[model samples]
Target: MVTASSLGLTERQAVILTVGFYMITALIMVSCNKWALNTIELPWLLLWCQMMIAVILLKVTHSTGMLKMPEIRIDVSKALAPLIAINVLGLGVNTLCLVYVDTSFYQIARGLVLPFTVIFAYALLGQPSSSLVLASCFTVFCGFYTGISTEVNVSQRGVFFGIFSSITTSLHAIVIKKSLPAVNNSSLDLVYYNNVLSMLVTTPIVFLSGETSKVMATLETEGFQAFHSFLAAAFVTGIFGFLVNLAGFMQISKTSPTTHMISGAVRGVLQTLLGYFAFGDIITTGRLSGIVLILSGGAIYTYAKDKEMQTTTKPTYIPMTQQDVDGNEDNERKA
Candidate 1:
């Protein structure tokens, strides 16, 4: 069992605390992004700003020497090129979806990620999945259709961006897996390197999107006060953006992977409710039913995957590095 050694908390206490914080950070990141983009009207610029803040936080955290952060080098750039491209695309599309969609409809919009992920895994990695997984994907598909069909004032552009984001998200997961070798298989390093590369890509886009003109217009119309308000919102969103990743990492380290995934399902439910109360988002019967179906499918998929892992007699990947070997030992010990 994982313990909060510094806090001297028992395993259950630690798990609850860690998972709760992880869920909260995830929720805040979404809500903050929605709030920031609501008035900003500049998705590319906001993305650039958030990535910049995340990069700064990562550098500071890496420099503190408290955590074992991988030393980023230039050599890995080529290896991470594909992932970087997908990361930028994914972030851009997700931001666009946030800009165009309501907070309550967000999950249903991205509900296709599971199906896309399963499809990509099979296509790219030649991995075989069980029938339960396919059934769950079908359920997710139904949920997405149910939600969109019932929206009284749905944004077609938002739905398009959302679907594109789902594809990128699923593609990104596979790309990240394949690119892990470039970062010494350290997820922390991947986050650091991804932000750095994504920033390089988004900086020019910020200007290309005419965000500078928008900024100037706002300043001229509302003065520095309005500009400062936007900045404050972006700053808060950026902090949560980075913290959400750290929270997820901490949750995984402090509990089993199963627990982490399960918490995500719960977090989605809470996010739906949070959107309804916090943002005056309408929760129609169809929307609510769609969300329930999606969540149910996701939870079942997670369970099926976990059971598949437990019953499988063979390991998937060959251990290439000492790190991989040690990780294998640790996983076995935990089990």
Candidate 2:
């Protein structure tokens, strides 16, 4: 029989396991959100509830010493404000797109994220890229266009929100990369601060958007049983949402952002297949071609970037002193 110690996994195995967990939880959260949106028609409320639950859980963890709480200074909060704002808007619009579009189409629509990310990285951060990378992004965009054009049950509103979601999502990622180190927080700490800030920012918007009134009306007209069911779904989805964030952060911490991007591409394919089998979504030739194009382009971009990084990364050179050389010689002679 294999003992626990004998069965211990290596660092690479651990990273793989974490990436798998992140992808699964992320896919589940998206599916669950889509389901809840279809059933309840309250996307903003669901999002707010998720943020609230995340904040509560994070607090509990911190109080119990299960997690460390980051130092929350006004300066750090201000620094993260823009990122938090973009994150909230991205998620809100993403949820709205799910409400409007079929799950299958939604996956295809999200293929624009990589291209948009590249564009924003260049514009905002002055990051330069190779022609190959740009061409790959163009291929990805063509895939998105092909998928959207061929979507039989396409919603113009869904398409609109999806494009905005991609833009905001890319911006959020770029800002996180820029701001995360300055804040000097761990992944969990960032999660905590992000949800806390999101809750604060979205609360008034929920009321102003008239979603609060709708929720109240839903509770009154739908009866206690229906209301309870909605709450239960929201709560479960909230838990999944937190897991997604936690796992994503853990994966990125253990691996490179490039690895995370590749995992996301894989997850997109899995999600597309799941949408078809689970929701009876129609799969056309164009859809298949689009998926292939996007995944291939993304993989190429990731590979090219990884190669570039390898070439650009310089090994640290530590000069040896005469004393150090003498010590090494002495040790060698003794050996």
List per-prediction Cα lDDT, in the order shown.
0.76, 0.75
Off by over 4 Å in 1: 1-21, 62-64, 67-72, 247-265, 317-335
Question: TM per model?
Answer: 0.84, 0.86
Instruction: Give lDDT tens digits, candidate 2, residues 81-156.
Output: 8878888898899899898887777767777888887887678767777988898898899888998888777788
lDDT of 1 at 94: 84
Which numbered prediction scores highest in TM-score against the true structure?
A: 2
Candidate 1: clashing pairs of residues:
none
lDDT of 1 at 132: 97
